[model samples]
Target: MSKSITLDQPDQRNLLDRMAQGTIGKPVNRLEGPDKVSGVATYAAEFSAPGAANGVLVTSTISKGEVALIDEASVMGMPGVLAVISDQRMIARPAQGGAGEAPVQQVKQIDYWGQPVAVVVAETFEQARDAAKRLKITYNADDMSDVVLNPEDADSWEEGPGTETVEQGALPQAMSEAAYSVDATYTTEGHNSAPMEPHAALAEWDGTKLTVHASLQMLNYNIDELADSMGLDAENVHLLSPYVGGGFGSKLGISPDVAAASVAAMQLGRPVRVVLSRQQVFQSVIRRTETTQRVRLAADADGRLQGFGHEAKVTNLPEEEFAEPVTQASAFLYPGQDRVLKVEMGRIHRMTAGSVRAPGEAVGMQALEAAMDELAEESGIGPVELRLRNIPERHPSDDVPYSSRRLAECLKAGAEAFGWDDKDRKPAQRREGEWWIGTGMATAARIHNLSKAEASVTLMEDGTAVVATDMTDIGTGTYTILGQIAGEMLGLEPSDVLVRLGDSDLARGPGSGGSWGAASSGSAVQIACEAIREELCDMLGCEDEDLTLKDGFAIHNNKRQSLPELLNGRSIEKLGKLKPGETEDDFAQASYGAFFTEVAVNAYTGETRIRRMSGAFGIGRVLNEKTAKSQCMGGMVWCIGSALMEDMMFDHRDGHLANCDLAEYHVPVNRDVPHLDVIMVEERDPAASPLQAKGVGELGICGGAGAICNAIYNACGVRLRSFPMTPDKLIDHLPEI
Candidate 1:
């Protein structure tokens, strides 16, 4: 039997106020609805005009080794073939104080599988693709190329933040004194974004200026990188990515497709369009690094953590680098006496891996949350209770007070909603014919990171407002949310507010990543609206404090003046930006969630299926409930994929990705997911930003996989350490009846 207790009364008035103040808590429709649904939204590959030249990218056959020869004559002689460009002469070394600063400009060494060997440009895409196949290239084989780091080889690799040459040999010493320790090694296979539309770019050069329609996350970053690669002035490059199918961090930088298209256009004196093939997409674009994490956790007798250590090694390009930072969130997520978070790197003959969704915490939470579940079981306490008991009121990293922390509230609410109190903690106690029933819980936390963003709001004579920013939507509802904010501030309906984004020429806002787009961009739009309101009051010569703007009309002395009449044919434009304030330094702001799952496991086969899953999110404020809920649901679906089927297999013997296509690498389909119950705990945190909203994008996926894993353990009396808790692994560990 279970008891339900409702501690806090639902405040409908407050909820309505939140919705009325802005679209901060409402479920407004997406602003780009018509564009997306009506097939009017132009993706990179669909922007081709007639007579545009085409370029085909050639990928390296071998994982490693230098290109021995490039015979381009046959490719050049092919019909409609314009030219063949390789690393031989056209690609120059980066110049000093030029655009290609950083690793983007660094060199011609073939460090990983799928590296670009050459590019074939022609009058038609078919001709270019055929020409690419005719190119002759040989490699000087190196046995050291296929080398992968193992536990025994861990010591041989250098330690640093993805750089070579640093003080090594720290893991052994740290693992020694860990009181309650679990020295478990976990591996996550490589995965690519595999967006529906492959990476494509259409570049046209009008002598001095170059314009590129690209598939990129950061338009400005792409513009700068392209300018540097082409040795042109940064001002000469104009990049646009109005719509992106999906990025998942793969589109963070300008990939070879963009660079190849630009170079081909420059050479042929005609516009060039380059679209990478599915196979080339697999090899050339960046993917999530295959990481192996060795984690050592030490906690006191009271289950209070004392020491935490994590070391991760990733397969990355010889020159391209990254630190998995798997131990980053561990420093502050829990209350600990001593914490050491060190990141190390290993060079492998693989594609360069970059940020994917939540870079550090996403993977870190997988190991950390699972370890927390294990520790809770070892302590003879429920997972939810253990987390509640160990909750920290402040951030451990800097001992700063939290502006708002509703994690405990979220846990309590989630437990009540999930019927946690009635759950059978004993493994294999409840059985339903061929299946065993079990329940599990896990918690997630994410820091709120908002950047300086600027937006221009123009109040037109037609009683409408247009908000323009360089922010990319990325399927996260930036377009809708920004329009909602502008609509509220300008006292107009959502339809009356037009939102323009994803062009470098617009008011520059932070590119949508790190879950900062909504908070940062919304705040910028708010500031701009405030400026416009102030300007309207100044023009009316009325006391700014005494005037109230509503329903597209300004009221002064019981007289209503329409915004269009007030503007008097001249558009009212105001630009505003939001910078980090002292509150950011004084207070730690983070979003928290409690994920609960109930699953059924087959007694004999150990097959597991999730019955129901619920997430109680305590993000500061819910901006557009429909979109936020969708984001959470999407993440949950992603978690379902990660928990059961997602993995990129590599042929360890040859250093090639075995499962490179969708047919081999699996994600969760509609059949895998059930209805996900999401509850948003609305709490306002002034520390996060003026919007009082935190990121909910990655938090939903953080601990969801672990929760499912824990549930499976309770159902079948099996403790599986590795991921994708497949049926075979579970059956092997199942106890005899």
Candidate 2:
């Protein structure tokens, strides 16, 4: 019988805590850490096969046009060049994670810049690159390709995914009646995710069967999409992705390299490999869209918000139908009845905009919290106090009670830890040795999304356990946590639980995106382990409470039974899946937190440095102390980058990026980061899952950038409406100290 669980009510014991194995919540080092550091782990491009061909993808030079001419004869005869394929089958658009509409595969015309135009295959990677450069290609450029977003283009704008009136309750009237209000507009520059691993795919075909080793997050979803892209049955495709360097959100779907390599291998009847250069990864991969937001807040004398309006404009390709869901957290982040939330998507030819990191709230909150700081100033109220006053008793928009919310607690705890009262209230008040010191804080909230996931656990004759799932560990410490879950359930150490992941043959997981990977997949693992425990209980003729499982032994009435003996000449395996329950629809479920940051600004140079950072996050349960802390710290560092460093620059003339490589597109290095402290606030939300756990991965990013941005303002008394408050922009705005 198949086992299943829908998290409706809270599990009384939550298995992990009740088991008390001293392993589930402990600080466990990654099981694969040694392999990763020692170079034994094989990534997608590292996999090798005999007689394999290397394929180089050729991207388009023009922003938008048709392939007017391309010389196949120019490169087909080159030494070691096997084939120069310009087939449309090699050109499929990227998938937008989950089960989004598959992109059009065969397009003779280009809609955006840097679209994959063709590919060249050769015996060696060097030969393929050499031949790809030799091919002569030209485009019949079109004039309509020049599309740019304008604030005045309101006449052409359409309502986003949700209607404007869905949550806007007499917002205009409330704004007019309020005693105090702050209305401001903020714009943010666009950026893209740069994982340590550039996308790569290795494909091998035997007869009609195909196997692809690719860097991917969702295995089953990718298998279906890859099979569809190749026009083959899903049964004929196998995707193997065991370890990934990092995904952020880039590897959540089918990348261009996967399709090109698969097509080349199928055609050549041998293994073919495709690896993207850093430039190609930046030019073709999805990006966090730039946004312009007009946030208006109206509050009473007591600093209680009366009205809220958040209208944002974001962009994507003219044909692609995905835009940044910029107002995702605005509907419920604070308490206000007369609320208005909207998103306007502009159809532009800039790099196709899609999910990068915390898609909606990362940029959205940067704009919202800045306005909040402005509101606090306008109302003559403290910043943290104003946020506290606006905390909602119920859902601000839907009128639903929260499943579990601790924003106020998080703020208070973080403030206490960060010395909110100790910091001087006056902006630019304290300066020493040409440095202006200041502190800032912001509220953090992110929607807790859950997807269906399945896993299988097998008990071996040697008393060891094995957990199998198709989830990829994108440096998020998934392998360690999965073992922790099984070990907690089976009464064994995490090391004794051999966890196999990133293979399509294993049970399908939700595939690690949207911060739902751990909660959803862990729930499935819990259900499978519970099912086996129940079977063992029945075989022992004892009730669940009557049995005790510990250290590879099951004891009832103090009579011990070896776990391997229970497996006794039988294939003891249980398959399980977890589904969304009634609580999701009944409540507004979200992870909540607060960020406090201290910064030192150069009095003369307008340069800013983050001095110290601290955050308190309420993500329900901390699965692993070390990994959870790492996730928060990584996100906080991302905040440092988003606030002052990272920006994706494009040529306004051609719509192509000028600084497409990492050498120019700056990310935060070790020197750019400072001291970071993370506090995981304890929460046990039955509504989250059987584990009573929510994700801590993206929570820090929701308002993390805003905290640092607000700090820069406090330090130099400059309210930057635009993002990446780079020193050049600050020099002109800074006060004459």
Residue pairs with backbone atoms closer than 3 Å in model 1 (clashes): none
Q: Against the unseen true structure, what C-alpha lDDT does each candidate score?
A: 0.73, 0.83
Task: Identify the candidate with maximal lDDT.
Answer: 2
lDDT over C-alpha atoms for residue 404 of model 2: 90
What lDDT is obtained when candidate 1 is compared to the true structure?
Answer: 0.73
lDDT of candidate 1 over 474-558, digit per residue (tens)? 8888888888888877778788888998998887787877787887888788778777777877888886566766678888888
Best by TM-score: 2
For residues 321-358, write the lDDT of model 2, one tens digit per residue: 66677888888888778888888876676666767888
* Cand. 2 Cα-lDDT: 0.83
Candidate 1, residue 540: the lDDT equals 81
The positional error of residue 728 in candidate 2, measured at the CA in angstroms, is 1.2
Candidate 2, backbone clash total: 0
